[model samples]
Target: MYANPAATNRFTVNAFLNNDQFACVDGYRLEDTVTEVTTPTNQPLPFVFNATDDHAAADALRTLSHSEPGDEPGQKWPAEIRSLNIGDVVQVTAPDGTVTHLAVDTVGYIEIETVGAAARPAVHPHTHA
Candidate 1:
């Protein structure tokens, strides 16, 4: 059974190192709802990112990462990392006052992998230093 899209969980993405705002993609559903996982090597404990195929939402993510193109020519991108790192955390607050945190192990995209499929170039998920 599919849950109501409107009742979907809210997520707040932020950098693990500095707690800086990364991106806020609202009403996004997870492909799998497993909150935590343990790998064989115990490296990255990635969570699924089944983001809605919304152009504005994608742009917001790109802008937060400083990957969005500037308005003027010869403009330089911000000095911050242009993608989320492996250790980045995604925090989810429940209506019951419980909080869940997921760490970035591997990043994945939904419905925006192809060229010209998105409003701007789709930012591939990456790990930063």
Candidate 2:
């Protein structure tokens, strides 16, 4: 019941057991998790996003990262965040100078994702620098 067996033997780890972590997403992550939602679909997901080019993005990131379940995730944004479920494309510039753009997608944490998706988009453009 395994895919590869070269290392760790299924011990790869992160915040949650059997999970993985990353310092950045396309190197643009300026930034989850209860089973609060019981929806059968993943459509119209909630998300808060901002480019790393501004201070507001950093603020939004801080608010989101520090938020916990049962807390108002959307109420703490820094006004530079965006909420969209259309899976719009986001561009991120890696620290190594590589640029990549990807449509919004999530790995897990539906509950928190819902909160972010429902948050309001900022009044300005959120594309990264």
Candidate 3:
């Protein structure tokens, strides 16, 4: 059994059985247990949507700080982040032409999708949980 390292709200550990059994961080094993199974070693972290202050969120607008469809080489981030990691707040351009801000939810050496691209207002999903 293994637990997601990035899973918050619990500190001890968690185990998900192959047959739909679950164990809480506090070690309460769920009924209808199943045998252990091998999980992919490369499983990614879960998405943790977050929020930010109005002034701060507005200030982290990426499009305004850099890039206009295209920017000079290395002057701007690639389609994916080249130097940022989880817990870091960054700016992103939405598909609807909105310049939004988001806090990274999954740390990795490469691009990871388990992050909120939009800085949801009024919901601090990360810190609160």
Candidate 4:
């Protein structure tokens, strides 16, 4: 079996049978029993976003910090982040509870698919899961 490294929660396998009788080498019927197996390694860890800013920016950040359903099943955004403007400072909380302060040096926006077609300020991080 071969698994895709980028897949977060799924498995894929290819198998070949030796004979057309659907029998195991030991003469047991393949469909008569169930076999269970575990993955050799755990799945990849997910990215966490914890940002804080002043009133308006913080509200915008929180509003955009969400995942929208994709066309494919089980598909979703890996992190809760959005574009940010220059000079905006935000405090991010790590998974271990350690907090780090980050300053936005670039401008970013999140597009909204509305009748008027509007965009809002966002905080884009360097990395996402």
Candidate 5:
């Protein structure tokens, strides 16, 4: 849910209990006409990652740690691309403890292991820094 920053509004939350509280078919109610369950009160929120370098060749692609290209997922292959994926905003932590945020728009697959002679020549220039 989002609210407009330019608008000024007021809201209120109210509750009433008939006999201290109400109960539902599920469990006890903290308030009237409500029910409470004793499943798991503490649940961890999932992390939303916009980008990830969790590939098997992450070590070989370390040079892309700070590089950002306008890449998107499911698009036609570009002339020069390393690795890519489409996801939510990814929080990146640099070696110096600085955090960076980026939105992954695309995912790419580069077959570095099965490069033919022609493909190998084109990819050799990009494999190195």
Candidate 6:
């Protein structure tokens, strides 16, 4: 994500079926989940919703952060996140039903979705006895 940090919510992040140097750095995919944003002060950010999408949700924040919004996302949305801020807490759910508590941490010049605060290992295929 250092090159562009695309699709990140003013964040450098991504996820896929396979792990990479950047995507899923936190070990959880940002889709198929509902993410809650809060500040160090403990205020939970409300869903940034519109007809086309909820900008604050993981799906939009993860994808739209990389691409531009469509023609009619309208005026309710703000560029407030010109990217996310440090100490902004994000609670994201993984596909296997785990919540990863991430706090925005800036490393050098790049922003990282700090991992292991309360993160769970990503689910993998396993054999059953």
lDDT, residue 93, candidate 1: 34
Per-residue lDDT of candidate 2, residues 76-128 (tens digit): 32222233222223322333333333323343122112233322122122232
C-alpha RMSD for every candidate: 15.8, 18.4, 19.8, 24.6, 26.5, 15.8
**Cα lDDT of model 6 by residue, 39-118, tens digit:** 23434433332222122343444334344562223322123333333333344443333444443434311222335652
Between the candidate structures 1 and 3, which one is better when assessed by lDDT? 1
Model 5 lDDT tens row, 9-114 = 1111111111221121222122222111011331211121123332312221222322533222211212332232232122333323333333232342222222
In model 5, which runs have C-alpha deviations exceeding 4 angstroms?
1-87, 107-129
The Cα RMSD in angstroms, rounded to one decimal, for candidate 2 relative to the true structure is 18.4
Model 1 residue runs over 4 Å out of place are: 1-8, 18-82, 107-129
- My TM-score estimates for the predictions, one after another, are 0.27, 0.23, 0.21, 0.22, 0.20, 0.28
**Candidate 3 vs candidate 6: which has greater TM-score?**
6
How big is the positional error of residue 31 in model 6, measured in Å on the Cα after superposition?
29
Best of the two (2, 4) by lDDT: 4
Q: After superposition, how far is residue 19 of candidate 3 from its true place, in Å?
A: 42
Model 4 global lDDT (CA atoms, 0 to 1): 0.28
Local distance difference test, per candidate? 0.32, 0.25, 0.26, 0.28, 0.23, 0.32
The C-alpha stretches of model 6 lying farther than 4 A from their native spots are 1-82, 108-129
lDDT by residue for model 3 over 25-96, one digit each (tens)?
222212223221112332221111112332232232233223333222222222322232233344333323
Q: What is the C-alpha lDDT profile of model 4 across 55-102, one tens digit per residue? A: 323323323324443212333323433322333333333333433333
TM-score of 3: 0.21
Deviation of model 3 at 48, angstroms: 25
Q: Which stretches of candidate 4 lie over 4 Å from their true place?
A: 1-83, 107-129
Q: How much lDDT does candidate 5 score?
A: 0.23
